[model samples]
Target: MDQPAIPRPRGRPRRFNPEAAVATAQRLFHARGYDAVSVADITAALGINPPSFYAAFGSKAGLYKQVLERYAHTGVVPFRELLRSDRPVADALAELLEQAARLYAADPETTGCLVLEGTRCIDAEAREAARNFHLAKEEALRGFIAARHPEAAGRLTSFVSTTMAGLSAMARNGYGLERLLASAEVASCAIREVLSTSEEHPS
Candidate 1:
């Protein structure tokens, strides 16, 4: 049999670092809320032009959504997973605060969460999407609470969900790990008080 010669590969693939671009976008997005970050800002941050950005990410909104997905899968997922841990609810809540602390300790310019920051910027469609995401997170936390502490599920669900939102705001406000832990301890104490109060009243 005659051996066919293998063809050499063609020219080099287009050179662009999507991860770098995304990280830049994430930083810019966090620094300024979604509405404040124009396409030009993204391009300027990535050191690229509008055409290149659109070519790479489809659109500004597309890139925004992608960065959001990155945060959701990486940041938010772990927060929700803490609620699912076999540890006690207070411990799980503390775990979430600990993770928040770790994030603060890691990122020098960390500015809390995007969804919390963008909640006001989101339009009708984006608001709906945010709502769904929040609801899903609540359901996950609630499921864990129901499974682990049925009697306190309702109160704990409300407490965790509401304070999660507040924690994101606190992060945006430049609250450090120590301040956040102090706030968490206070919130935990209040939560326990409410739980105990509710148990007594059964209302």
Candidate 2:
């Protein structure tokens, strides 16, 4: 006698790549911010259920941290390279700001630096996560400047960091590329003046 027919599996099987999931989460987090996107939202985006999501990332925060890691690598401008160049500090910094403007406005949907936006996230752990990277960039700039203009190092580093935040905010606020570039040009001029005065005082 023929055996009873076996039952077919239920709805669509979970179809998502763990690596691809991180990228998808990155887009969502970048566009909507961390607190705004829910575990359910990620699960839906990844085409997986809550159980699968937990298995893959542990939690929403865990996924966000992973996304942050990916974004930190790919999303921001590579200032470290510019800072390392033998070019004069003022010139390197001007290029750095110009690159920042381009990166921040590269995508209208995900305008702004991911880490900067994460600093405002509701979760304390996430905020600390972002802060670590932010502070590292600041320290790198400070060291580069201190090597040449020690007196102006702290002040100029602060200036660059503040200007970067403003650029990110403007990009997110729908400022076009031209406008962002204009802002960066003004910042570059400020950098030149700062360097000029630092050279004049030499203390």
Candidate 3:
């Protein structure tokens, strides 16, 4: 009296390399943005079906959340490292901006910062997700500046964030690395000027 074998599930195997899927999806999202890349697009790109995708990520937003985390670790600049407390704050910030420009324009096919660009996404959840990363970066920048230049922290942080956003937009609009570097240099100059002013005024 042997027991009957359990019936195998139908359709494509419910197995996919989640890490590989995230890597593939990051490229898609980076190239086309959040709203533009649909679940079907992701599935077709990954050679998997909706059920597999859902089982792996729960939903499009769920996958996007993972993608955002991946981008933060891999795609984004290492802010904590670059904003070293031992170095002059202005120089550190200048280097950070230059690095960002090069990275944003590094890939012509996938221009702009993924997390920054994702902030403008139409999906509320995705947009909020990106914003969380954006806000965290902002706080980090602020803290770095406040350590040395408490008075200039607020304005300098704002200026740096705004410049990075502009650089991201310009890169997305086909600006080459040379032009982006020029923009970054101009931003660096502005940051130095602000710091100089703050030092001179002593307020």
Candidate 4:
């Protein structure tokens, strides 16, 4: 008589790479907002099982936090370099907004900024994850402006943040680069006015 064969385990073989998984998740989250994506979607895309996904990421929010960090470090504007430049405050700010318009409209299919979109995410933890990047940007802007015009740093940072939000929103709404550039030009004028007025007031 022949011996009975032993049955093998059911689920797919585990070959998940956390870094590669993060990169894949980053794309899915960027293409579709955080709330829109699910663990099942990620697992399916990465060719892994549900248990493997949970074991690798802990939870959806956990993976999202990692994705947000990756996006902040790599995707968003290079604010530290741009804001800390040797150019005049008004000129630097104008360049900053102009650069933002270019980036926001770079890809028509995947428009808008990942960090900015996260601000409106329904998940509280996700929202905070995004806000941290925005706050860091504002702080960088504050430091740059304070070096030149100490009195106007707060207001100027607020203005820059608002303009960035608007630019991202317009890009997501299908606005082209030309329109975004026009908006950026108007914002640049406002920046000039603020700095010029601060110089005059000296309060």
Candidate 5:
């Protein structure tokens, strides 16, 4: 009599890499947004089973949090480097906006800022996760502006953040790089004007 064969346990594949899974999930989430990409979709994309997905990432939101971190580290604009103290505030800030315009439209498949798009996701947990990154970036912008132009820091930071949000949304809507760059140029002009006015008024 033949012995009965035991079935293999259901779980992540032996070669499964959590970091690679996060990168794959980042692509799906970036292309489709958080609400649109389900756990099954992620698993399928990563060639894993539901059990494996759950074992690797506690939930969809948990995976999204990791994706967000990866995007922040690898995909996001290097604000710290761009907002250097050596450069004039207006010039550096203008360059930041211009760089954002370029970045937002860099990828046709993964258009727009990932963290910005995540902020509008339907899931509360995912939305909050994205908002945290957005808030942190805003704080960094405020800090950079406050260092040189304390009086206009809040207003300038708000203006830049709002403009970047608009750029991200436009990029998601299929706006090309040239159009975004034009819009960013207008924003740059506005920033320069604000800084000039602040210096003249000195209050």
Candidate 6:
């Protein structure tokens, strides 16, 4: 019998290398600011040429947006579930802060929240997207409370989400795990106190 034939080299790939490239883009953008990261830097990280990178990600801005979008959506759904959980909103927020701290501690390089980083160098359109994203997060949180505790929805959503926003930003600013936990603890305590106050004084 004749030996099995070897596959011939195809001029172009049948499948675009988006997965590896996109992951690489995300990593690079997190490592270097978007404006600071050159296309060559991305190509080197991905081990692809500029043409291939462009083919896979379109443009630098486009690639950054895709990466940022992925990072933003990572735990959002599960996080929403936590918001709707019966564990008490304050406890749920505490859990989220712990998770965020662990995530950053595990790999500070890949785990810096991209949406926060992306806002630094983007144009008006991208800034608008970020604003809309925060608005949606706030709204989802409000709906979560409204569905479960209609009477206290407005105040709880505003305060808890604000605390979370501050903690998230603090974590991104390179706070140590201990510092992060302490910050979360403070937020949790405040949440609990506010809840106790609200319960005591029903309006």
Superposed Cα RMSD, model 4: 4.9
RMSD of each: 4.7, 4.5, 3.3, 4.9, 4.4, 4.3
The better-scoring model by lDDT among 1 and 4 is 4
Ten residues in sequence with the least summed lDDT for candidate 3:
194-203
Q: Per-residue alpha-carbon lDDT of model 2 for 45-104, expressed as tens digits?
A: 888889889877887878878987897678877877898736689999999999999999
What is the C-alpha lDDT profile of model 3 across 1-203, one tens digit per residue? 99999998886664668899999999999999899999999999999988888888999989999999998889898898998877888899999999999999998888999999999999999999999989999999998888878899999899999999999999999889999899999989989988887753221
Candidate models: Cα lDDT each? 0.69, 0.87, 0.91, 0.86, 0.90, 0.65
- lDDT tens readout by residue for model 4, 64-131: 98988787777788887787547689988999999999998998766888889888999998888888
- Candidate 5's residue-wise lDDT over 83-182, tens digit each? 8777788898889989999999999999999999999989999999999999999999888888779999999999999999999999999999999999
What order do candidates take by lDDT, descending? 3, 5, 2, 4, 1, 6
Scored against the true structure, residue 125 in model 2 reaches a CA lDDT of 83
lDDT of 6 by residue, 1-203 (tens): 99999998977873446766677777777666576788888878777888877777787777866776776755332466566545666577667666655665456665445555455555665555556666777787777656645667788777766655565566667777788678768877876776665543211
lDDT of 1 by residue, 130-177 (tens): 566667767777777667567778877887666666777777777776
lDDT of 2 at 49: 89
Clashes of each: 0, 0, 0, 0, 0, 0
Model 2 TM-score on a 0 to 1 scale: 0.88
Error of 6 at 13 (Å): 2.2
Q: Could you tell me which 10 consecutive residues in candidate 4 have the lowest summed lDDT?
A: 194-203
Q: Candidate 5: where are CA atoms >4 Å away? A: 1-13, 200-203
Q: Model 4 residue 146 lDDT?
A: 85
Q: lDDT at 43 for candidate 3?
A: 97
The residue ranges of model 6 lying beyond 4 angstroms of the native Cα positions read: 1-11, 14-16, 72-77, 150-155, 199-203
Write down the TM-score of every candidate: 0.76, 0.88, 0.91, 0.87, 0.91, 0.75
Candidate 6 to truth, TM = 0.75
Best of the two (1, 3) by lDDT: 3
